[model samples]
Target: MPTREEVIEALEAARKKLLTEDAKKEFKGWNRTIQYYFTDSDEYWHFKVEDGIPGELINTEAEDAEIQFKMKEDTLIGLIDGSINGMRAFTMGKIKVKASLKDISKLQKLV
Candidate 1:
């Protein structure tokens, strides 16, 4: 299990990744709100990616989230920090995602 701060830190790192030039190219024309629900901590955090730029993380439920992920705090931390692979986690049932194939594929770049 991970603390709230650790999960936040991991999210921040993902946001920072979107700041890179390559990331901008990769996520171009993408605008979506992604939410994460931590089962262990009962926490909700969401962020928007607009035209390749990532918005600040918000600690609330998303009004119209395009992609939603349900998992434990440790799983989220591991995914964001590269300790866990996203596809592997999903396949292993460590994470559950509610998203379209295209949307899910796009997010694979984040992990």
Candidate 2:
């Protein structure tokens, strides 16, 4: 299994790739926030995308987020690294997402 720092680095790389896409450019204008909680260590990290740039991490629970997703830390790294697909994992009961239907749909585009 990869370490927490490795996972975070991968996620950041993935986020940067997504931000450069034409479809994701609109996200740069929105105040988008995502919270990832590593189930194994029970550590929560929050990310915010603002003004076309990824913001710094914030240590706080995302009580009311536009979208929230849950998955094992290893699984999350795999998904972000293209080793696994989010839909496939979710369909196989390996991942869980909680949010409005619209947000879930939007997540498909984001992730």
Candidate 3:
């Protein structure tokens, strides 16, 4: 399993790839937050995306996020690297999300 810094780095790379392709526009006007709980380390990393930038890292006390995803760190790394499909993993119960179906659907496109 990768460390928290490694995971953040991977996510940043993914975000850059998405942005370079002009994919960030897909999230325009969308303000959502997601918390990733890495089971191995039992660490929680929060990601908040609003207006533009790749969102910010937040502490545990952050308010209710619009979306939250929980899964093993390795699985998350796979998802970011395109080895795992986010939607499929979620449907297969490997990834758990707490959010509206509508928002979840939109997130699928982004991932």
Best by lDDT: 1
Candidate 3 ranges with C-alpha deviation above 4 Å: 14-21, 59-61
Give the worst 10-residue stretch by lDDT in candidate 2: 14-23
| lDDT tens readout by residue for model 2, 3-86 | 968877866765665466664675556566777766776766677766546677665667665556567788888887789988
Q: Write the per-residue lDDT of candidate 1 for residues 65-110, one digit (tens) a residue.
A: 9999899988878877678988899899999999999987776675
Q: What is the TM-score of each candidate against the true structure?
A: 0.90, 0.78, 0.78
TM-score between model 1 and native: 0.90
After superposition, candidate 2 runs with Cα above 4 Å error:
51-53
lDDT of 3: 0.71
> In angstroms, how far off is 45's CA in candidate 2?
1.1
